[model samples]
Target: LIAYGWHTMVTGQNVVLYSRLHLVCSRPRVLRGILWMIIANWFISNVPTTVFVFGASSANPGPFNRPYYVWERLQLCLYFVQELIISGLYVYEVTGMLKPDFHATPPPQKERRGSVLSALGTGKRWKSRKVLRHLIYVNIFIVILDISLLIMEFIGYYEVQVLYKAFVYSTKLKLEFRILNQLTDIATSRMRSS
Candidate 1:
């Protein structure tokens, strides 16, 4: 159930990203892109923790059939690989954090110098109008990259949950069998000694 919830939550972030990316312009667009990056990172980081908490409950074994005991190990392996790729991409994205170039915008100016407020940075704090085009490009790239990452993350998350569930169940069965064997050994020894 938590797996399903995580799946839903990741998908929801994608929807929000898509909607906000379209209507926003300039600074707001950049803000939206940065927001997407943050959310994606948060969810990705939580994935390993989720796996630990739920064990392997997310894995579904209906597709792979053998002894039912052997189950499917490949799916779980794939989950780890996919997680690695997403984590790598996030590392690359974080490099942008130190990039002031991306954040630069046109500076706003006023013709009137008489206003007391004009002395403060707020009056001229904005980026110059000349660089608006570059800012637009930076924002657009952020939006596109964010959306792509989200799609990949959604796919990976589902796989992880399904594979985790199946693996946990198989492990539990093995543990139970071992416990029963120990009990049988003790019972047989008591009878023979008597």
Candidate 2:
């Protein structure tokens, strides 16, 4: 995961530099560096998290088992890493707002002349925009999914310790949340238009 992140960083630099040089490069290298670092951190942090997810799903062990111990530890480590990365990303974003560009320049004109939403249809920014949007949506779903799993874990720890049952329940919650969130977007659009 770290290797993949490093590779993405190397490639993303040239890609981002080419498309957004006019905007991002105008800032000091330090600011730009911090921005990229935050993203790289997020990518690296996901590695162990993914492993823990797969391990927990397959082994279906309670929190007390030797096998479950390793996965739980990995999950905790990944959570802490993600928290740190999120904090750093927040700081980087806020500090970037303090830079001279923040005062001198107006916010990048939003895509009002056209429509950023059009990216969905044209397949140009779809790779960048739509994919990213759905990724965010899925990540939100994952967090909710994790919360439900944690609750079930506690229940299992106290009561029956039925790992398979909790797994099924958590999986169902994840699917339901995903569907509801998609519906939420549609509902919001309708409400705003009305």
Candidate 3:
């Protein structure tokens, strides 16, 4: 039950990250590649982690202890890198959308004239850009949370690390809905209006 729960939470969090890429990114190839990496990382990290964690806790733990210790460290390292890659991609895409020349298509005729008239005033693009910048901040906050988990993991408190992960993942999902969803809606509307 423990191993299964751990696998679900860890893998599920990555899937959520993967699913949100469409909000800021338009490239299907990049999205597909990332999905593959997440799946591969799951198999590469989870199986041994489950086996070792279980074996290390068994009645005959002497042999399993050495391999489990080494493998768990490797597994955590893999997870951290996989997470950083996904978050880093999210940051990159959001930042790209922040650029002035990001959109390939020009705005409609009316919008272009209104944009010229309201040169001094902020517009939807500006608002979305602001939201996107704050989105980066949220990602940084999440990275900090992950760092705290690493600290706990290194401190060798397995129980506390597990509990803390649930808190961190829940917080991330809530932040995503509150902020990322706003940006997604903005992007979607712009695409349709264009």
Best by lDDT: 3
Which scores better on lDDT, 1 or 2?
2
Candidates' RMSD to native: 24.3, 13.4, 4.1
lDDT of 2 at 14: 28
> 2 or 3: which has the higher lDDT?
3
lDDT string, candidate 2, 50-120, tens digits: 55445555666454355454544444344434433433443343235223322343224475346654432
Q: Please provide TM-scores, in order, for all candidate models, with all chains considered together.
A: 0.25, 0.28, 0.81
The lDDT values for all models are 0.40, 0.42, 0.76
lDDT of 1 at 141: 48
Q: Which runs in model 3 stand beyond 4 Å of their true positions?
A: 101-121
Q: How well does candidate 2 score on lDDT at residue 158?
A: 26
Q: What TM-score number comes out for model 2?
A: 0.28
Candidate 3 residue lDDT tens string, 1-194: 77787788778778778877766778989988988998899988888878887888899988888887777667777877887898798888877776653343465667767586344224655676677778788888988887898788778987888788789878877886776677677777667757
Query: How many residue pairs collide in each prediction?
Result: 19, 0, 0
> Global lDDT for candidate 1?
0.40
lDDT of 1 at 82: 40
